[model samples]
Target: MTSLPKTMHAVAATGSVPLDDERALLDVELPLPELRPRDVLVEVAAVSVNPVDVKTRGRRAADAPPFVLGYDAAGTVVAVGSEVSLFAPGDEVFHAGVITRQGTNAEFHAVDERLVGRKPSTLSMAEAAAMPLTTITAWESLFDRFGLRADSTGTLLALAGAGGVGSILTQLARQLTGVTVITTASRPETQDWSRRMGAHHVVDHHGDLAASVLELAPGGVDRVFTPSTTGRVPLFAEIVRPFGSIVAIDEDPDMDLRVLKGKSIAWLWESMFTRGVYETPDMVGQHDLLNAAADLFDDGTLVTTLTHEISGLDAAGLREAHAIVASGRSIGKVVVAR
Candidate 1:
């Protein structure tokens, strides 16, 4: 067995104590995790922040100790648990880990091998790090939830097409499926980015989302994927073609799902962590899709969405990264590379 470092420096949330300070991240030393039967220890090279990270940090329980806060990561495997067989010590891998466990904001992280994939050779660690979480969410939304086929031709509408998940969702619907992707963006830059990502049409969500979409599809769209704010359920109901499906990843506790009844529209939720968080029998599906995404990236069929990046793995850098995400103005993704 290769020797492992005894302790690793990581950016973590300061203990459960409530605070009025703007700073939520702290640099702390934590002992390296002991591996489980199917685990791999990765020497992390890059990590990224998502809305979930900020939400999780905000909801941290009082009296809780420091908590690591990251999900998307790219790194090299340094060791594997006794029962592991998928990867060797020197392999490069990337994954969006299960939310129930410690996160990847450290020098080293232990993740289940089933949740990871071989890194795309064409991408640097930072580029690869920006992919996993968003890619997985987009993939599942299109294929698993909507049952979209690569050869089926129709229209798909993406709400907020320039954000992290929306950016990738637009690309996947365009490149992998036969769908004519129409995405919504409010700014010139966001519209340009969405068009470049392969959207057939870009409409402003700030305007009438339903009108903009109906102008193109006439009837409605075959599927709708929204990764941003979710209060637009009625708008989605108005524009979704009868029997079409609407999938979302955000929480909309106040959403009136009854609007879908008139059209018999399927309103579904996609949580990328459902497989890993529940330890499902199909957990390795994440690994499969990640590898599929890697192939597309390497072949130039899909593009990396890493738009912003920062240096260092310390607390200050993490705080800054989180601030950008919380601002709700960040396009694509914000990464922190060591």
Candidate 2:
């Protein structure tokens, strides 16, 4: 085995302060991550900022240890644990790590092999990094939560169509199913981006959302996928068909469930980390989905949503990427790469 460094460069959230505060995220040196039986140590080449990172940063306790805050990563494996059989040293892999574990904002990361997948042959590390988290979330929302299939025909209304999760959801739903995809975007660029991602209809979310959707999908939509604006569950209830379903990824503590009771509408939540965090029997399903997505990427059936790229893996670059994601208007994924 090759000798590895004792410590590595990393960026961590040192305090629960605003993004502008220098103490919010800091450059630090941490010991190389310890590997478990199912783990593999990766030399991280790139990472992408997501809304979770911004949320996690603000919610870190005052006295807690500095928390690394990246979920999406693409890197090369440098070593594997005793029971690991999925990958070997020098293999390129990508994954959206579980929230319960340490994050991937470091020169090296240790991740469970069941949660990782082979990096797409056709994509650069940055592009590959931009995908895993959003792809898994979107995949689970459409197929696992809503039970959408290639032959199933219905209209799906995806709120915030140009955001990271929405971007990939649109592509997956359009290319893999017979359903009509209706996505919401307020800006011209975002509207165009939504169409390019395979949305059949792009409605202005700034206008009357229900009216705009009803215009395109009369009789209400069959499914609603909300990555943001989850507080509008009542509005979704009014716009979804009887026996329809709604899946949300954002946190909505005050969301009332009674609104959908009359129509028997199903309300579902898709958390991609649930399996990995709990060590569920189907945890390896992520590996299968990611490998499937990689094939789609290689065959040109799907494309990376990365729109902004920052050079370097230091705290300054991560802060910039986090700021972009926190702005809530970033068109696609913003990545920080080596």
RMSD for each of the candidates = 1.7, 0.9
Tens digits of lDDT, candidate 2, 53-154: 999998888777898879999999999999999999999999989999889999999999999999999999999999999999999999999999999898
lDDT of 1 at 327: 83
What is candidate 2's local distance difference test score?
0.94
Give me the candidate number with maximum lDDT: 2
Q: Model 1: per-residue lDDT, tens digit, 280-325?
A: 9999999999999999999999999999989998887888888898
Count clashing pairs, candidate 2.
0
- List the candidates' TM-scores in order: 0.96, 0.99
- In model 1, pairs of residues that clash are none
Flag regions of model 1 displaced more than 4 Å.
Answer: 15-23
